[model samples]
Target: MTGLVAAQGRPVGTMGRMASTAPLPLTVGFDLDMTLIDSRSGIAATYRALSAGTGVPIDDALVVTRIGPPLETELAHWFPAEEVPAAADRYRALYPSHAIAPSTALAGARESVAAVRALGGRAIVVTAKHEPSAELHLAHLGIEPDTVIGRLWAEAKGEALREHAAQVYVGDHVGDVRGARAAGAVSVAVTTGPCDAQELREAGADVVLADLTGFPAWLRAFEAARAA
Candidate 1:
């Protein structure tokens, strides 16, 4: 759970279909990469560019498969520990040109966030991605969140979620499940990232959906249950 906090007292992450909530807005936290945006094509392209620039071989295909962790964590697999910082910097530098253009929203991403906003809830993105890169992807696709917090993963994501008063956290990774639970938020896992439904369930996800397409209905049910 490597944490990259945003100064002091910053909020982050959440999800669903639709049902008007209480007068107060509910804050929901989301994982950026596979959860909201499918940046694999762009990420792999960036890695290829980085490998070309550094003359170090990186398995771009394999890299995209594990997209939840920090950039440095992936770089560690290829670069020497001492070289990771420099490599990570280079990757971020290459991301805008190589990654952003090809990046796209996962299924129901826009609707899921919109559903939250429709209910007067705040939709926030908490990701291990570089903040600037995350913003670029969102801007490119026009899938907006109220707030975006970057460089946070696993349980470290809880810090942002807790600060934001998020009651629900949605993502496509087990790390995301851990993050939601760490904040004492309901973990809604989507099988759109690296993890499968069984894997997410085993990780203690409160609910599992095939993709964000199911989120709206699930959210409606969730709101009904809560209101009940």
Candidate 2:
């Protein structure tokens, strides 16, 4: 889409630089798991519990390390293809208890959300997590995004981004870069998740940061430059 290249020939990999004439984004989308919350412990715990109950040997480390993909995808990795559906059901059934309390907001999560709101922009979370679970995390963190979309990943997430007219999409996975590109939104990748900066960039991230901590400041600078 035209919006994917809307930055007017600016270098996509550079942070804190936007064209002065570029339009300021009014809607921003965020990924939930690594981008906003540190959920590895909870996710690992749930998988361990599932393994115990089913007598299936699940590698807790592997599960935790692969958090960005949907739970079904993870389940398929651990279970036989034919058994994946039932295993996914059991995982979801046990997820809430193991996940909720252990989850915590990542550094700058609140401030990043605030930065978007401070710009009179709407903040929305688009994630591959189940809707209820994603909502639970947001409620527990006391972060009220304008909307939360769940169970959509990669290009599927682009549909929601387009629906919201999101101008910027921030995430911590390669899938997020694909989603942002699909939606024609600016892709902001953070290295807080399993993927490294180079991996995210290779997946087509327009901008990359060390973590969410740098986002608010970069966003402010972008807006300031736009206004100048």
Candidate 3:
């Protein structure tokens, strides 16, 4: 099971979803992409499709390694700055059909979400992927988050979290951490994205975990800490 030390020094992970022995105080949120699903396969396939259309052969390894962040940002990395916009558009056009369903949720992701909902917490998914595109991804992956807000500007996530009344959020990227902090949500970092532990720590995540397999217990602990 994944492990994370809560603010109150409680070791959480195994059986973490148990109701907080203490009073609780916060809503929960989640990020998509690497946080909920392993998007590498779909993302890589989308890029591959784009490459085929543009007649540019890209190394699948190189493409798969950079799957987080906004699609536009990825386009910039894969193509020249000037061509990024067009390339990104093309990528998005083919992505839904080619990548969404093929992308599978990460291990233990759905179970953790269910645990959150069972605990009377409202779980929301806030992502930078375009709304229509994100919907496709969710549908393809057979996931239906409580509420999904997508196609947000990188910085807009914080504001969205605030609007959603999220008190804590789980994510796997620096941007996710920033958005959660900006919205005054406790940032729980998961090492499922391109970022490493050191990088996430440097980004000031409140808690870090290897993955969501052990999130229920942490959520319970978090609720308890909030109540206190």
Among the numbered candidates, top TM-score falls to 1
What is the descending lDDT order?
2, 1, 3
User: How does each model score on lDDT?
Assistant: 0.89, 0.90, 0.80
| All models, RMSD in angstroms | 11.2, 8.9, 10.7
| Cα-based lDDT at residue 133, candidate 3 | 80
Report model 1's TM-score to 2 decimal places: 0.88
User: Evaluated with lDDT, which candidate comes out highest?
Assistant: 2
- What are the per-residue Cα lDDT tens digits for candidate 2 across 1-228? 332333555445332354444665688999999999999998998989999999999999878887898888888877999999899888888988998899999999999999999998899999999989999989999888999999999999999999999988999999999999999998999999999999999999999999899999988876677566
Give the TM-score of each candidate: 0.88, 0.87, 0.83
Better of 1 and 2 by TM-score: 1
Predicted candidate 3 versus true structure: per-residue lDDT over 1-228, tens digit per residue: 457877776676533655545434356778888899887887888778888899877776786775657777767766889898888788778977888777888877888788778778777888888778877777776776778888664457889889978888888888888888898888899998888888888987999999998788888887766766
Displacement of the residue 136 alpha carbon in candidate 1, Å? 0.6
Task: For candidate 1, write residues 123-200 as lDDT tens digits.
Answer: 999999999989999999998899999999899999999999998999999999999999999999999899999999
TM-score (C-alpha) between model 3 and the true structure: 0.83
What lDDT is reached at residue 59 by model 2?
93
Q: What's the number of clashes in each of the models?
A: 6, 0, 4
